[model samples]
Target: MTGAPLLRVRDLNVRIPTPGGELHAVRGVNFDLNPGEVLGLVGESGSGKSVTLRALLRLHRPPIVMSGEVEYGGQNLLKMSEARLRSVRGSQISMIFQEPMSALNPVLTVGEQIGENLREHTALRGRAAQDRAAELLDLTGIPSPRARLADYPHQFSGGMRQRAMIAIALASEPRLLLADEPTTALDVTIQDQILRLLLRLRDELGMGLILVTHDLGVVAQTCDRVAVMYGGRLVETAGVHELFRAPKHAYTLGLLQSLPGAGAQRQPLQPIPGGPPNLRALPPGCPFAPRCAHVTDECRAAEPPLREVAPGRLSACIHFDELPALRTELQEVHA
Candidate 1:
């Protein structure tokens, strides 16, 4: 973290024109990713976690305006030409989308898809590309990689298809990987396998990873640090251990309390009081004010800026100091 970050994002905002109106999807999001560090983007659905991820790559098409800086290695990705960005997309930065069935081309064989990346990014061709494709598949723990290459996506199981997605993403050996809920639609055992595989690949390949998920347990298990997003903004960000040990935001505490800890009693989970705010018409003040247990009149006046509440910790709560006291109460309730 001391050195220059591999990726630096600041004041990122995205707007889309919908039939209803303009939808503000992501607002003033800021974070940094160091070389080989894994940053977890945690939040419930519609919190803009996925929107921020896609914006980093300029994946959102036009009429959906995106502003602010996404600097990668001193270059701003947002300002880059489509041609230049394409060169960096798969070879330098890759993403494992949330779903494989729709993301993968059903008509193409698995090998063809993997080879496409190779053909575009590398000099490897023909037999060489095929061999490397097989190697990549094997690396992702898919059995009989050579044989599987001939199979279409429909032929592979769910887990195998996910692995194939990873294989294609890594075919170019990107320096940074953006995974949007990579473990979704997988069984517990398979989820564990995918998470382990991701961590292993990160360690072995020394890649910076951004994992987007709503599960705090997954964040606790895989992320080095976590950035909790709410209503299209980052509410809290801290080291995994520190965030879990001493959460400094009401929304973050709500998330942790919702999780059933080890050996917890058999009881109903404490769900958050209200649903997420509507992005189309966000509140004038803090979007989470309505649902926040510790909300005050001041909270409803204006949104608090994300500021350092502690060393190496950032929270967007005006009464961040009061959050620690609620931790005890939360523990007692869940106990």
Candidate 2:
């Protein structure tokens, strides 16, 4: 994290024209992704986790507009031409979408789909592509890899379909992988399997990954670092252990307090007050101010820039000192 990052995102913002008005899906987001690191983007629904990831690949259609520098190896992805961006997409970066059935081509055999990727990105062709496709499937732990390659998306179970999606995403040997809710729809057992597989693959391939998920448990198990988003803005970011041990944002603390306990008799969960703000008409100051118990008059007066609150950690809270206190307060609340 001290050296140059594998992927650097700065002041990234995404806006889309809606019937109501211009929707600000992402707002001035910034982060660094180190090589081979698993970074989790955690937030509830509509927090802009998926929107930020999709913007990286220019996948979202207009009337969507984006402004930011997404630098990978010194090139700005946002400035690239369509042809150049297309080439950069699957080769340098790939994404495993939340729903494999929606991402996968139902008409094509799984083998053919992966083969097409190999042919496009690498020199593999004909039998070579087919053979490599099977190997890729095997790498993702699909049983009878070659036999299953001939099957369509519909032929695979939910877990198997996700595995297939990962295989296809890995076909190009991308340097960075964006996984949007890769384990969301899977059972707990299968989710564990996929998380383990992703960790193994990241180590083996030495590829940086951005995992977008709302489940903090998944983040704790799968990520090297975690970034918490709220109302399209990053509220806190730190190493996984550091963030869990001492979060520096009220929003992050609220999320941890809401996680269900395993005990037979436990107190009611302390969920955050209110819901996410309307992006089209965000408040004049911090978007999370309404729901943040620690919010001050100053918080509603102006937005707080994401600043370094601790070594290698960032928070956008004016009263950051209150962050550490939330742990004990939440414990008493639940006790």
Candidate 3:
């Protein structure tokens, strides 16, 4: 993190028109990703993790308003023209979407899909593109990749489809990859395989990655840093081990408590009380104030700003200092 960041996001806000009103999907999100760093975005469903990731590439179409400075390599991606953005999309900053089954074209062969990317970004064409596609597939650990190139999306298993998605994303050798729940649809073993494969590829290519997932276990295993998002905002961020060992935010502590421990086989999981707030009409103060056990009268007066509470850690909580003692108390209760 000493060198200049590969990607810098500042004051990112996304709004989507909804029947209820304009849904504030992402709210003033900001983060920096250094080269070769893996930053995990962990949150419950509807927490805007995916939206924020997509905003990096300006992927959303009309009716969705995005305001932010997504600077990469000293260029503002948010202000880039559509044609310019298209050139940057798969070549510089690629994305592996949540579900490959839907993302992959049903009518096209895997090789054709891959060749399209190669044609768009790289100079490889026809037979050359096809050969490169096979190489990419083999790199992803798919057996007989050359033969699989002829297969359709339906012909591949769920795990293989996800691998194919990864292969397609890597066709252009992007410097930054945005993976949205890449392993969500696979079995436990396949999930592990995918995570390991992603890590290996990141190391091999020296690429920065942003992984979006609800699973804390995945973040713990793969990410260098973890950003916990809630109610369309980042609630806490820190180094992976530091955040796990001693969470600084009430919401983060609640999330850790909800995870099932290895020692407590029969112990009931302590679910976070209440649900995420309604983004359409978020509470005036801290969005998590209603569900936070550490909530104070001051917490409901105005939203707490996300700020550094310690070295390499950020938290949006007026009571962040009390969390360590509260964590110990939660452990005793679970014990």
Candidate 4:
């Protein structure tokens, strides 16, 4: 923990205009990312995890509306001018997308891509930029950096491309790195290598990281804190150990129990009962109530506000107090 958070998101909301009406993609989401900490944002597809990250970077297109404070280094990113945001984006914060093939330029060499940021953010040029680019490649564990500098992205393997992405992201030495499923396309072995590389970079650079993914296993291995989102809202947040040890929200417990290794042999994994609620026509109460086995009448009528159930543990379920009993029963049934 530091004196003040490096990034603070307060009461964030994002909506889009649809033919039916407006779709609420995110609702009153709030969190903080401290320096040198890894915050894991986990949820199913369409849970607004990607949208929230895009909104932070001001990447959403037209018809998509956003309201909230994204405070970074004393400046509200949401309120900054386009020019100011441009100054902040690469130099102060960098983002890595899941698909490197799409993110990288097909026409440019790997060195040219990494050097682009250095040229834009710094005064380095020609030989200096080339040297720095090679250095970044080396930093990211890309072998034979000098030899690879002249190679195009298509010449590299999937893991190498991701490593190049990391090199580009680190070229600016940003204070924060937003990685959206950075290892999605890689094989399992390569995925582990990438995860270890990311952890190494975080330790060596002391930069804050936001790893957004649907894989709880990734979160368990790489994150210090975890936030579970459902229906575009944060339903639970806790330290990684606390969350895995005794999850407080039904959704959180379900997610943990649903892991492939959570149950016995030949038994089907118990997925969360129902699909995520529709953002355009969400229910009045808890968005997860329909799928939650612990749901009650109150859960259907009134939305439960996120409240602190224990020190540094917060859940949005009304029956969070009874989660322990429910967890035990579910484990027994699945055991």
**For each candidate, how many residue pairs have backbone atoms clashing (under 3 Å)?**
0, 0, 0, 0
**What tens digits encode model 3's per-residue C-alpha lDDT throughout 1-335?**
68899999999999999988999999999999999999999999999999999999998888999998999988899998889888999999999999999999999999899999999999998888889999999999999999999999999999999999999999999999999999996898999899999999999999999999998888878899999999999989999878888898999998888887754354578899898889999998999999999899999999999999999899999998887632223233223
| Lowest summed lDDT window (length 10), candidate 1 | 326-335
Q: Sort by lDDT, best first.
A: 3, 1, 2, 4
TM-score of 4: 0.94
Which residue pairs show collisions in model 3?
none
lDDT of 2 at 26: 98
Cα lDDT, all candidates: 0.91, 0.89, 0.91, 0.89
Candidate 4: tens digits of C-alpha lDDT, residues 101-196: 999999999999998999988889999999999999988788999999999999999999999999999888899999999989688888888889
TM-score of 2: 0.95
lDDT of 1 by residue, 1-335 (tens): 57889999999999999999999999999999999899999999999999999999999999999999999978899999999999999889999999999999999999999999999999999999999999999998999999999999999999999999999999989999999999898988888889999999999999999999987777877889999999999999999878887788899988877776444444466889989999999987888899989999999999999999899999998877877632323233222
- Tens-digit lDDT string for candidate 2 (1-335): 46889999999999999999999999999999999999999998999999999999988877799999999889999988899998989998999999899999999999999988898899988888888999999998899999998899999999999999999999999999999999987999899899999999999999999999998888878888999998898989999877877788888888888877644565588999889899999997888899988888999999898999888889998887776643333233222
Candidates' RMSD to native = 2.7, 2.9, 2.9, 3.2
TM-score of 3: 0.96
TM-scores for all predictions: 0.96, 0.95, 0.96, 0.94
Cα lDDT, model 1, residue 249:
89
Q: Give candidate 4 regions above 4 Å deviation.
A: 262-268, 325-335
